[model samples]
Target: MDDTDTHLLRLLQHNADTSHAELGRQVGLSATGVHKRLRRLREDGVIKRTAIVLDRAKLGLDLMCFLKVNFKNNLASPNLDELHGAVSALPEVLECYTLTGTNDAIVKVAVRDHVALREFLQRFSEAQSIIERVETCIVLEEIREGNDYAVPKPQ
Candidate 1:
């Protein structure tokens, strides 16, 4: 991507609702040119689907917790696809990733309150027999949460 493309991505990252005309005005391109570029970016997979970020707290999801999970079986021996599929099906689990360390995987969960979180954990534990232990850390405050990434200038 060139400088103009990088600029366009940065602008879209800040506000996906930005108009093509406005983007053209800022990037010194015509509306048609901006649209073409954006289309190309999307086709190239540089630009993924645009989505609205929500305030979890306002939506009654007051609890955010990170769970470190260790499996009873060895990592190489277990069927990871089954584990991932089970975790992904849980509504409360926002993110789950396999990690390299003491824990086999890490999960980020959002729930209504402590009671809800407890119930969610109980359900999660029951979902998979491979889960040996789960360590949770409740997020007291979220100072910053964003999906934006830095777009480097073309070399």
Candidate 2:
């Protein structure tokens, strides 16, 4: 992708609701041109999907925590698929990523309160026997949370 495509992505990242005309105006492209570019980006999978960002606090999700999961290496064949499936089945788990360090995976979770968190953890631990240890850290304050990535500034 060129500079123009990158600029369009940056604009959309800020506000997916921005009209094609408005995007065209800012990027110096015609409305149709903007549409074609966006379509191409989507087809190529650069623009995966668009959805609204919600306020966790407003939704009564007052607790945000991270879980560091370590697996038992002694297992001849770890049931990684089962662990992943369990994680995916839980709505409270916002995100999960495979790690390269001591932990096997890191999970981001959000819940209403401590009781809910404890329940979620209990279920999670029980769901997978391969889990050796799960360490949790409650977020005191979220400075920033977003999917935005750095794009080159428009000239």
**Residue 93, candidate 2: how far off, in angstroms?**
0.5
lDDT of each: 0.90, 0.90
Q: What clash count goes with each model? A: 0, 0
* Candidate 1 local lDDT, residue 62: 93
Query: Which lDDT value does model 2 have at 77?
Result: 47
RMSD of each: 1.4, 2.3
> Model 1 over residues 47-113: C-alpha lDDT tens digits?
8898998989799999999999888874755547657767878999988888898999889999999
Against the true structure, candidate 2 reaches a TM-score of 0.93
Q: Flag clash pairs in model 1.
A: none
Model 1 residue 50 distance off true place after TM-score fit, in angstroms: 1.1
